[model samples]
Target: MHDFKSNPQFQKLQGKKVLVTGGAGFIGSNLCEALLDLGVLVVCLDNFATGHKHNIEEFLGNDRFTLIEGDIRNLETCQKACNGVDFVLHEAALGSVPRSINDPITTNEVNISGFLNMLVAARDNGVKRFIYAASSSTYGDSKELPKVEDRIGKPLSPYAITKYVNELYADIFHKTYGLDTIGLRYFNVFGPKQDPNGAYAAVIPLFIKKLMNHESPVINGDGSYSRDFTYIDNVILMNLLCLTTENQQALNQVYNTAVGDRTTLVQLTELIKKYLSGYDPAISKVEIVNGPNRRGDIPHSLASVEKAMEMLGYEATHSIDKGIDKAVKWYVENQHSF
Candidate 1:
């Protein structure tokens, strides 16, 4: 979307064999698609615990795209997926603070143990780089505005703890095993193919689905809490930069992957309603109800994308408004798939 073909680093990605863990999930599926577009051979490893088969169904017929139905928790599965892969984009994990709180054991088993398995497999197989999906939740109770990479606070939730542990493990792997790694700490990412159904669905797609169905969407608080609502394409660009950057300073470091902007829940709902109304006028009148804020919910979250810009030449191609418009259009066109 950002003229990737023009970037020489991106040009180097062509014909490389890359393995994407959790390639059937929302973000992973999107990554797989972007890599395939650049003529990169993609091997997707997904257990489908949360990832949907429908997400990667389109790529099933592509010769360059291979999907391995396996779990990262199993060392052998990770080893098999990493075999002959040039790079690894690890996106598998149990996401959601509330869900992790409900079952910390499974979250730890997957996010921490599975992550370790992948790292060991990558190291054993001689993969050049391992780029992972880190979380802004790792910021935890830090009341910091525009979160920077070096500064972090104590984790608040089980999910947050697991993600923070990932950064630690990755750094250790680089220092001890010489496995080149980069962790992209993603903020509240949202866009097409993101699931809107489930107890732990993210706010954007969940709100979009509710508004489309003319159901009253609940706001967790007074709708004042905000997030650095990032578009999927922006995330894709960051992953490409992580995969292709030649700078030694950029490797084995964590960077925030966000647009350096924030939008309140109130503003987000208005934007969604405004866009969806074009497809169905009834969406304009969808009710928004306020509920008590849940435990461990951050009041506000933003990111400093300066590090990514300075180090990787990363630039966000879409603002929240533009991203919402595109996402709403997709949902409208494919509402029957839900």
Candidate 2:
């Protein structure tokens, strides 16, 4: 894993206070842990809707860690979390395309309305910077090989629409309120601490869990769908860079936070099996089942990180192979936790 403490750039945030919305969830929890390691104060705001208490359990005892049990959809809760915070790492959202399709009203209320609430609170509280989790789904139906920041297509799902709106809102907030912000359009992020049992669990953890039990993992399509499978550490690095970088140009912009490579679902399954077989050889024999193609799923997704590289001095530290190895090991050893 990349060590933030050893980097002088990250050392700049040692005494700052950061409010991480949805800080009890997978990516949010990992960001909290990283911030704590850098000797920074972390305020975690979560409602335990999709996030679990156990995820942030270890940080509860830390003096610098403060847990606010609240939902982002509540304006007062968002205001309370932003009070006296130097920066806002807004990670709260209702993710998953299918879940949004089933209930877009709620999704819109949370992802869009709640995001606006955070912007208002951040503006009112005089937050120095606002960094948020954008999504790759914003690429939508664009058939481009490498999804660039400026180029996009019509949203294919309600969830995609919400994420794209977040970018627009953040941009408007910056221009209208002079509130510096950075938006990270994350690709398929996966790693440790991600839930593997939820209906909306990400592909990596879900597949790992199934293979660990010697069960057949189901593919939503013919296994040809591809994604730029980014690791949590890379996402963490991008957030930290956005927080610490002094370059003024890096602010008020959205950058692709990914490895800039693609992997087919079939290749991903094979990789998972290979890694898990190290723990249980029988997993290698388990067959992969194919189901009808899932709605709102893009056939292929890739990213161009040239912008992040040029603007934020970003470099991906984990590739798909290295990431899968570490993720598989984590799931196998920490099977009882989930």
Candidate 3:
């Protein structure tokens, strides 16, 4: 019953100094915006490897906002960003199943080595909290309806393995090094600024972009594969909850940050078409190619939010329908540039 839309942990951030690695990426940028809105001094670190400068361009002149263009793999850069920062939200990673499958070595280097560097830096700086973006892909190959944190299966892809490794290292850091860290297992997060032009684009924005161009969007599988599809606002709430929550029992743990619901790609497609009809009815008629099942694809993924609710006080406001509309509108406004 913990409410996220009007969060109490939010007030705990005012006057705090925060460093958000990968703060230029989609989720990271959204997080940076929220932190700044709370009157917190925000520092963003990114390599531009997969992040866009335009995402954080609006904050360039703000005194409270600082952008550090660097890779997290460099220990020195990590230390520099962590210096004098109160909370560190580490969101930097190569985030694509296909991309990781195509080049796992690069993924491992960034996700594993880079994560370790941040951990070392945060420990050195004595940061108050170390919150990172973990993925629900950690529930790989599990046939469960709703994924629970304590229970997990073998990682299906390199991306999944890398994320699971993050949780492992974080737990070790807490027990071995005495640094308080929390991991948020995000399930299919989508929203504004999610790059739709990339070869490995996420579903919502990529499909919206393709439909806007009057092109057929590929539906990687038979369209039956479902996801929890948490929205950016929900994710932003969870991140804030992790940063400021004082529940001693919740420390040194991971929470599944997602709406406890399911929507298949076909259902999502219909929802998008319905929403875009108001903007441009032509999008409703766009073609969708039903391709074969994708490699490393799971049939369904739903998160059991009982833990986040009981401990972290996470309450997801936007369901898939409402979240998709917001995402489609953002894509419609921005699709012209690319």
What ranking emerges by TM-score with the best candidate at the front? 2, 1, 3
* Alpha-carbon RMSD to native, per candidate: 0.9, 0.7, 2.0
Q: Please report, as a residue range, the 10-residue window in candidate 2 with the lowest summed lDDT.
A: 1-10
Model 2 lDDT vs. the true structure? 0.95
Model 2 lDDT tens row, 25-59: 99999999999999999999999999989899999
lDDT tens digits by residue: candidate 3, 89-176: 9999999999999999999999999999999999999998999999999999889788999999999999999999999999999999
User: What overall lDDT, based on C-alpha atoms, would model 3 receive against the true structure?
Assistant: 0.90
Q: Write the per-residue lDDT of candidate 1 for residues 1-338, one digit (tens) a residue.
A: 44567777798999999999999999999999989889999999999999999999999999999999999999999999999999999999999999998999999999999999999999999999999999999898899898999999999899999999999999999999999999999999988899999999999999999988899899999999999999999999999999999899999999999999999999999999999999899989878999999887889999999999999999999999999999998888888988
Q: Is candidate 2 or candidate 3 better by lDDT?
A: 2
- For model 1, the stretches where C-alpha displacement exceeds 4 angstroms are 1-3
Worst 10 residues of 3 by lDDT: 1-10
**Could you say which candidate leads in TM-score?**
2
